[model samples]
Target: MSLKVVVVSWGQLTNVVREVQSQLSGEAQIELVEGLFDQQTTLEMARQIEASGQVDVFVSGGGNARMLRHNLQTPVVAVTVSGYDMLKTILQSRTGDETVYFVHFSEIIHELNDLKEVLPFPVNQVALKTPAEGEAFFNELSRQEQPVVIVGASLAWDLARRHGLKAVYVYTPKAVLEALERAVELARVRRQEMEKTQRVQAILDFACDGIIACDQQGIITAFNPAAEMITGISSQGATGRPVGEVVPSLKLEAVISSDRGLFNQLERIKDKEVMVNKVPVIVRGEPRGAVATLHDIVTIQKAEHQIRLKARREGLEAKTTFAEIVGESQIIQQTIAQARQYARSEATILIMGETGTGKELFAQAIHNASQRQGQPFVAINCAAVPENLLESELFGYEEGAFTGARKSGKLGLFELAHGGTMFLDEIGDISQAIQIKLLRFLQQKEIMRVGGQYTIPVDVRVIAATNRDLLAAVREGTFRADLYYRLNVLPLHLPPLRERKEDIPVLLRDMLFKANRALARYAPVIAREILLHLPAYSWPGNVRELQNIAERIMALALTANLSEHQVQELIGMVLQQGAYEETVKIKAGDLSLRAGERKDDLKKEIGNLEKEVILEALRQTRGNKTRAAALLGVSRSTLWRKLREDIS
Candidate 1:
């Protein structure tokens, strides 16, 4: 009943705008806004319209409507020439039993074809791009003694009419009447049905509580926005999939057996305690779908904590500082120096490192070191949120941005990061459209909300991080080149754990001490042999893997009184398993071997095995030939000579 509508037209088309507005007078509140003068200003006009904040549905005539719709989130209803309008014009024409040529824009030919199928008279179609083209075509039609029906929306239609050709504008009387009737019927039906449906859907969507609806057969029929927000799975992908497949803890059978509503709290989903309300959606005394609403108990508490923190931050409470960072390695020192230098200048900083290498730690350190440190430090993972929701997460949205959007609306990360730093993690994973918007924000220091207007100026520093090679991504066309250049103003690369071998002992001692304190146990002495092996093994998972291994060792020492020898035994078992798997693969013919050879093959195989062993020893020693030669139990010169002979 309270639908807001905007009528976009040229100032000269006031009469036409009033006619259309009158039709929806009872159903919606209509506001008229003049759109762009030409196609080139379409995006700017759309932005202007959105900034006014007085429109919901953008009803536009002319070619600019298409361009406007492409730029804005508002539903655009473009008025086009309809089948009935063409038929009416043809029937009223004086020329009869003559070949009628319909001169129109090429894009409207499809609509003309549909009309041809229904009309009784035979008609010929010709596409004209401009008024001059239409006039030339009409002149040829006149020479052939054929009647012409010109259908277009620009000066082409006007010129065709002046040339005595039967011309109908895109929004002709017949087309306008048909469109108005359809709009009226649609508005009435939508108004009546949407009230109930929207209220229920709003509860399912906007509430922090997650709601999932399943049919009698336990097939998920509806996965609401809240459900998606909680599970990190999209509603579209979750629909029709089994409930158990979407969320393992739902236990659909329990609800079916009860045949009544049930309220409970479960701790299995996402390792969080969530309160749930499950009820059967019975229609005509038969259960159609079961609805379950759930809310994370911990998240509610966190929300309260965040509110207090925000208040405290605004009240000049001391915030996290550079002193809070606890690392002393040369790599860390160099990274900190770069962060400090870049903190004063507000250029975009790209922080690149492997996962768990503390890219976020460095980002936070940069924010804390900057002038905007006292404000919010908003961080978002581009890879974590689904593509559809990420727009709202970054730019936010107005109330009712979409079917499941919140009634009160939502604020985005950019808004939250105002006056501070917005750290976009895994920046390479963002979609092209989002990348463009982000690029614009970086260029202009302003953002337009997902379903909003009036670009809000944000005094924010951008810190982006990704483990991906952005230059490679640019070549692959996955990341935008312009956005990359914009963010790459200052680049800081954190060395992987294996490359900084000197830092291993320091990290180990710190992690061990932390683990011992947490476990309430004495720190087990790390044998010199174990410390040597640690640096030699590649830490693919980086610092996180090292921390986990340290914790595991500490747990073993505390619970089973495991010694350093036991740790070595565990490592040996893993290596043996890998060797066994490789041997199995070779025997299974998974690896190709050269055919039609006999004794030469055995000699080749022995040579290959010796080469592999030598290469592995050299790799473990980091290409130190002397250590490799010692491990091979061969003289240094003999090993060198053998390696040279193999190369030859």
Candidate 2:
């Protein structure tokens, strides 16, 4: 850390720098700016050096150093005059014939009389503060002696040289070097102090609590970054103003005047509520200043919410958007329209549908389409988990609450879904004990941990889905009627896939595409009759079953392309696997079967599959005989003859 010392001097003072630099080469760097020892030009030069902001100190001799020190903020070190320097200048400039005059710009060396007695020629000494005094003294001396010796600061020495009189500069190389050493030391100390101040300012700037400091008189001295953020007032506007007037809520004035400090005091800054702490700064048993720290209430709560949800929010998200549900059927379209409207309100939603009717799909869509889309979407299936475990998972549990409780305690699914939506799937299957707790959460918007007493307020939108008949359960005393009413604030019913048969072809095409992509080669092609026949099958598992069937068909198709005949055989196998036997037409004599295989089940499956395929084509053509025959890929007359024959 080499210090930049700008020495603003002319004449002998400027000439001495090279000798001074060689004395101390690496510790300090010196730049000589030739300037006179005066008020105007010298101070202006110092101002320019200070404005550059690279200078550490300004060094000069006599009046210039004094002027710079008095006028500027940057440090200025003066080259001092010693008695030895004076005697040397006087001895060097004199011949026994010429009188020696020593005129100094600073205070005169009081021991000059003693120096006169110690083998120094008779020297007249005087001190001059201004240039006019130096000029008058020089004018008087120029006429008095034909040949004379002059020794003094830059002005006197320079004037004597122009007048053809011998002159010696009083500032020796030793004195100038000493001043440079002082300048270098002062610059190092200031730099270290500045580094310390910057470190403290960095901590204050990044701290969460707003810091405001003031002088004893209550005038603001510092307002950190956090303070500006909380108050919405700039430090430029606040500092140097009275703290009480700038932020009246701080109560800094009272703290400065009194001995007591206020801690955790709630105050209002603009429109926001903030918690404040004010304290008096005391030094040596006397009040020196006051400080206040402000914490915005809303910002604090948001940070706490994030800390609690951080680890639990990883996979708890709603990636299913309204655009993902693919269907153009009127029945499905109506349900979507109603659900979209329901998403706008902050009310509990209860979705009712049969198995595989996409209840969770609709729940996720509503969540993504709502205002809480950016927050977490936590889902839990009530029927899948045991009754006691379900309670702990929904409400959390303190350490030692149960046999396997985590030592650090656990955050509940409801708590993790704070600031967003929570999807409680199979809500009807939960026991009455869990239902009552859910009822409390729905009414008050808060929940208590399993073993903990305090309630935590969770700002979440709850959307519940169930395939069970909740109303029937409530009447039978299995499900609570109060909880049902709470969950059914906004009711939505998703229609089964069979009711929207027109959408089957689209779903089948998408499913086949995905399945075929996984196959990469040798994709199976189903006959056109199988595609048309799908709409007639009473889809017991809805869209989910259709997807499973499509995937299975693709897996089987890797063997060979499946025609209408193969589909009938697959349908027979499919019905037999499911053990469906309502309309059994046992053609036991038909199949060459092993003794272990049942003949009646195969016949019954074939009969049911054939009837559904015939019915699906007729429905798709809207009961028009010719169109139905065309869709079935057969002649109209053959279909008419078959219908008349009662093929069933």
Candidate 3:
């Protein structure tokens, strides 16, 4: 028993359908089904055909198959007049360069439009409202020296030829017939390709491991669903963003340069040790990209150990210390100094800055500089963990505390940070309940785990950082006032890059040097003009923005020397093109007062101001020109010459 294929009539290609069926008669069983030109009748025919469950493949011309495909489970094959068919038909009907007209049905206008795009000669297409109208239009077009192309089926072709105008019949040519056969073959191949792609995507999506792919340039091309689940970043958010910007652990350039695949069971990122496997994807004997898969090794190990303990129990390894901190800004240095002083005395330190400004660096610096350097430095991002999971994460949980809870127990962040520092990032984002728990911990130096009765005493120093204004939050009743005062004991605000313009040159040089070593490229020279522009522009993303720009500059500078002017030009283009969300706009006057206007106008204004100042100074000095010159911070001879010139 063979699969039954159905062929439906459409347009004027009913004969063509029968011809194809005859050709395939011995190869397969094909059932020919005919329907009216009307859409509803065609759709009803498809529904009846589908109900029979006898059709295995649906074939028709123009929209017949398209309409049937929507209502039927069978494969659809649509045949239409090819471009070559329309072109050849028009050229053959023309005598010399004399104008020839072709008439087409209104339904096939789109095919005619496509023909116009690919055709060499200028062709005019007129749709037939009625056979008479089409004949009249064809006669009018026949008067021109050029040819008009009409695209339709056999019946329409005969109607135009009857009008005594040169008429060409449009249908699929031999080449097009072969092309359709190839297309069907290609569709089978494409289906296989789609299946393979979907399988790979599903494996990447559902796997517990995080997967990330980067191009040869080290820019992230793909981040899988599991990657998003682990990293708390969505594929939509991570795509096109640099790997360094997203994961901060990928070390994209190093991975690219090594060429050799890396498989390490103890790689650390975001404070979790994980097994990482990096493989280079090579095409045509050249490296194209790299794929990395990572899973939390410690969590996996602990889970494995738990399973074994039931047969055996297991183990761990962690701070805010200055030695652990990394930054070289004067603002950071001053912040560290203040944090150190407060750290030894048990004063709550409030480290304030924009997100990613290294508030945790300051917290660590304070912890390291203090007497509690030997203790654990537990850091938590208040905004990262969900509210439901936040309490368990902060305070720990007893066995069987909730569904899917570990059989044994979990140590809260406070317990883990006992005898050291707890750096809370985005502290202002914490809810009132968490704030209450935090305040109690600060007041009593004790924490009660979820579903646990006894309070565990812990000696931990709290250092909190927030991009938000805690004072404002407090006034708005969103944040507790008591917690604000407690945390605000030693306030240190890290100024944004724009404010500390003096630090940019030093920062840029240092960043470039570090990047050079990491990226294995020569550090480009920093132009003074670029430095000047850095200060004028406001850095909404602050130090992080500067870091990213530096990386971008390094990447762009690989093939060319990046001058200060080039840097400014790039910044201007990005601003003009709306690449940067917030940018400072400098007018022509701001660039230079003489810019975009006549120099004479500026000189006149300068001259008037200069004369007024000189006269006033001379009058005040009682015409003792030497005194006026001293007051004006100029030489006595210069003032005398100016006075003489004015008098003359």
TM-score of candidate 2 on Cα atoms, chains taken together: 0.52
Candidates 1 and 3 compared by lDDT, better number? 1
For candidate 2, write residues 1-648 as lDDT tens digits.
667888887887778877667787456778889886556977887798799888888888877777788999988899986777766667777766787777777776668768878853567777887778877777777778557788877877887787677888888888888888888888888888888999998998889899999999989999998999989999999999998899886678888866888898988888889998988999888999998889899987777667766767888888887777878899888999999999899999999987678888898899989999888999987866878799889999888898988875788988889999999988977888998999999999999999997999999999999876789989989899999999999999999876987777666766666667543222223323344434244555577766655665665554545555666676455444332222122222222342136655765655455456557657766788876654443344445545753553
The C-alpha stretches of model 1 lying farther than 4 A from their native spots are 1-329, 518-527, 559-648
Q: Best TM-score goes to which candidate? A: 2
Candidate 2 local distance difference test against the native? 0.77
Q: Ranking under lDDT, best-scoring first?
A: 2, 1, 3
Quote the positional error of residue 260 for candidate 2 in Å: 7.1
Worst 10 residues of 2 by lDDT: 580-589
* Candidate 1, run of 10 with poorest lDDT: 519-528
Misplaced by over 4 Å in model 2 are: 83-99, 106-122, 128-136, 139-148, 198-208, 232-234, 257-261, 269-272, 283-286, 311-429, 433-648
List model 1 lDDT by residue over 205-281, tens digit each: 67667878888788897777877877778999988888877787877645754668887756556766677778887
Better of 2 and 3 by lDDT: 2
Assess the local accuracy of residue 346 in candidate 2 as a C-alpha lDDT between 0 and 100.
Answer: 90
Q: Compared to the true structure, candidate 3 yields what TM-score?
A: 0.40
